[model samples]
Target: MSGRLRLSLQYKLFLAFVLIIIVPISVVTYVTTKRVSRQFQDHNRDLIRSIMEQMVRAYQRYGTSAVAKMEKASHSREIQEISARLSLTDSLGTTSIFEALTPEQITESAKQVGGPLDLDVFTILTGDGTIISSSHYPERFGYKNAKLLSIAARQEGVPFLIQEETANDTILTVQAIQRIALDSATKSLIIAGGYRLLRQDFLELILSYGKASLLFYDIPKKAITRLPPGRDGNPTPFAQSPDLLKLARQISEWPNNPLQPDSGAAARPELQAEISLGNSTYMFTGIPLIGVDGAGLGVLLIGLSQADLYRLLRKMTMSSTIAAAIGILSALLLSILFALRVTRPVKELSRAVRSVALGNLDQTIGVTSHDEIGMLGAAFNKMALDLKDNREKLIQIERVAAWREMARRLAHELKNPLFPIQVSVETMIKAEQRTSTEFSTIFAEGTQTILEEVESLKSIIKEFSEFARMPKPVFGPTSVNQVVKQTLLLFNPQLRTIRLIMDLDDHLPLIMADKDQLGRLIKNLVSNALEAMGEQGSLTVKTHLGSPKVPVGAGGTSSLASEGAAERASGRGIEELPALARETWVTLQIGDTGEGLSEEAKQRLFTPYYTTKPKGTGLGLAIVQSIVADHNGKISVDSAVGQGTTFEIELPISQPSLAGTETV
Candidate 1:
């Protein structure tokens, strides 16, 4: 996970932006939701507490009022009259009334006393705490179940109040004990009355606080009974509201389930839990109901539904998720734009650098901005201009040097012939003074000498003129091997001293060329070979068709000045000549076995006015170069010291001539 974080600047920036936006949003959303939930919890606790306090006050107030009302009813005038009647019946006869009056009569007497009170139960008890007759429970006719009233009788004017639990119901009653004085003996009759706590009334109180109810665990029944349906709606059985029931059971059975009897607070019935009911959620708190005697009666389950809180939290989460998605997408788009804007200049600079490496110094980057990249581009442009200027200056220097060398060689050649002519003329002038006797012979010799030297000077001048004004070649089909054969024939006489070898391929193709130029090109190479051999070594001239796949190396001699001149005249550099000279070229190799040329000599071998032999015109190889150039051909020399020299010429097989004009 950490390794993935080590990404490029663009990605890192994107990640940074995402974290910056998303982290805060996530944290805020989470905190807000949690805080809201906590606050709801506090609010729920306060609400439940308020409801319980209301219930406690209502219970105390209602209970006190009920007890007071019951005491008033027990001492009512109607009750007193019924009491008087009971006293009269007893006074009639102690034994006779006891035998005649049935339990029904006792019940009638009690009802007549307490009937105006509209009580749920009315009963008569003897002074011995025996139930004589009951208004609601008539079956309790003879049971000694009036201990509550008997105790009241002992208290004189005080009435006894108690919550009586029976087999079928529980009721609250107030008993008024009155002593009846009689002739036979002292006797007492008690009137006890109260009302049942109906399930309907209890439920009404329970629902006064929001969807709440009372659960009473009947220990005898071993099951929880919902008192009744609350005011909100009909109460589903505890079996039906499983979520609520399960929690209620757990809380009710706390000490027995998860806590020991001595676990103190944990054993005490105060439970708070969240439950899911159907699709809605709720939070509830349970409180135990204790009697005045400090005995557990049942639990008072107080529930505050949490469905609204859950809905709020879910909505917040969804909103946060949506915000994060939008933020991430926007960040990604912005990062891409920023990255492109930042790297554009760098990419342009890189391209310029590549162009410079490839020797394209003229390539320039646009200085569109006043940033670092723009400054770098400006520097590069300045460097390219400087390089171009330096190259031109160097070419000029070499051109001037070549011209100076040509002038010096010309002067030296002309000086040689001119010096002899001057000396011969001077001798003639001196001879004329000597006498008529020897003047004729001296004059004749002088004239002959002058003519010969003049001829020599003319030859030198003519060679130079020819090199300067060399003619262009006229194209025609010509065999290179045939031309070599003819040139070799012309050198037949010199071949006797130097063995000649011809390795011309008979299958060699014809090439577009000038017959005379091709012959002259071959003749000069053969002549130089013969002369270099010093009349004893071998001279080999080989001709064959060159391979069309690979390019053959062919060019003028190593003299930059001469080669540059040739290229300029033809408007083609040595490297540019390949367009005219195709791969399907005719090759001619002319070699010689002799004291080979030094590297320096070979370098300038074909340069105009450069020659090694005395009395030799250097125009021969130069003329040959011009002729090959005119024919859209290339010429190159391969030679090593003591290993002789080989001159190879490659000409396109049948390219048309550039200049259509023919010159003889």
Candidate 2:
């Protein structure tokens, strides 16, 4: 009632996809977004820390240079040399500076000591803290500067000085109080005057430096200015950064004790990490440049920012997240595509099978891919066609089998009656009862005719019954090689006239069958071969082994076995010449050298009682065909008009019981 269903799997798959794949993917996308966000933050923080360390290193270099400047200012070696020329005896003694050096020579020596520590203002102080050197102005070098001298003298070894006023910024007053040499003994005197702090190079250095804010103060005139401090305690850094100067009161004394800003102080340098300048974060560092004599001269302050660190981190995280998402999405999409491509065909084949389950043999799984799936689709089509054809063939075979069984039954049932009738007819024909030539001739002729006809009738009934009622085979394990050998031996007498060849492989597995049926199968084939060859022709028996074709249950089937031997042989009997036909069949190929029949003769060869021989019963071939059918074997006659005939019989290679085949 159904016109062939032409629906494709894609239509059904549309429904299947909704049920299986689409919904879960939506949930996966939602989960992935949240996971991506958390990973971004952690990645950026690590990048910022690395940039901060680089800034720290740069700050350290500027600070160390300031320390070197302080060392040059405070070596104290030049001060010791100046003190060596002067003499003083304790608080009451005095020594003549003129004895060590004239004014011109002293002035020249001062010029020779060109640095901050070796200044031209080389002067000597008396034991009573009086300046005695002529290098300073006469009024400026003595007790008139008692306040500065007393500061150094009272401190004994410490280089103490008050700041001196200058025309521009200021000068340093370094008065290192020491003992003056007198009669190989020491007296309380002091050597001073590296007070001229404004070396031009030093001034230039103080101005060029940034970050280290300065405060230059003149103790004499109290002239204070925000001058940037140098490594030496001079006016440097005070002018560098206005902000640092504004916060001077707080930062002038750096590494400030307790570190925190003073209470009620106007400016408080709270030592900030100056996070950034120009969109970058920076660090502010302060290093104390100590004099060689261990006085806190001044400080070097720096600001190093790291905003680039933050920017780099932000860029890195954003880029990394985008790249990661793209990669993961690409992988996911490709995987989905690949999986669907491979499984699509399998699903199509599955649906096609379901249609077939409902007895839709015309349904086909069309080719979808060039790979294995396409091959499977073609194979399915072939299998469906084969199954449909085989189904029809089975019906025809059943009819043939039924007819054969009936013939065998009829042949069996009538043998009892046919035997006695034949006996009576022979006796009647033998008894003499002729009176006249006409009467005697008529009686003998008539009796002979009746007897012959009855016998013919008997023969017909016997062969038909035998053909119709074929026997069931009793099966057991028997060697196929042995069966072939024994059957050929039985035909040994006939073998003398015909050249025989045997090509059989040993080590063949045993087959299951009934012996008498198998023997009769062989007998029919051999007899047919003898008839085909006429008198002397070659006969060859070949045997080969392979895996048995057992029935498989698949594709709406429960028992799908191969076409077995007996019935197949019976069917093939239809395609033989009428002359030498039929026999019971098995897996024995009995070929003969003789003139063969045409295609037409081959087709009608196994029809009931069909005969082509002069004196032979056609029932012999028919009986052979029926017996072969019962045993599930086949007999096929392959021949050409002039060529010899080959009757290839394929039997179920099962061994048959010896008792069952005791008589064929």
State which candidate has the highest lDDT: 1
Across 89-113, the per-residue lDDT of candidate 1 in tens digits comes to: 5443334345646544755755664
- Each prediction's TM-score versus the true structure: 0.45, 0.36
Residue 99 miss distance in model 1 (angstroms) = 6.4
Residue 273 of candidate 2: its Cα lDDT? 36
Model 1 accuracy (lDDT, Cα)? 0.62
Off by over 4 Å in 2: 1-435, 485-493, 547-587, 604-629, 633-635, 653-664
How many clashing pairs does model 1 include? 0
Give lDDT: candidate 2, residue 452.
66
Q: Deviation in angstroms for 48 in model 2?
A: 9.6
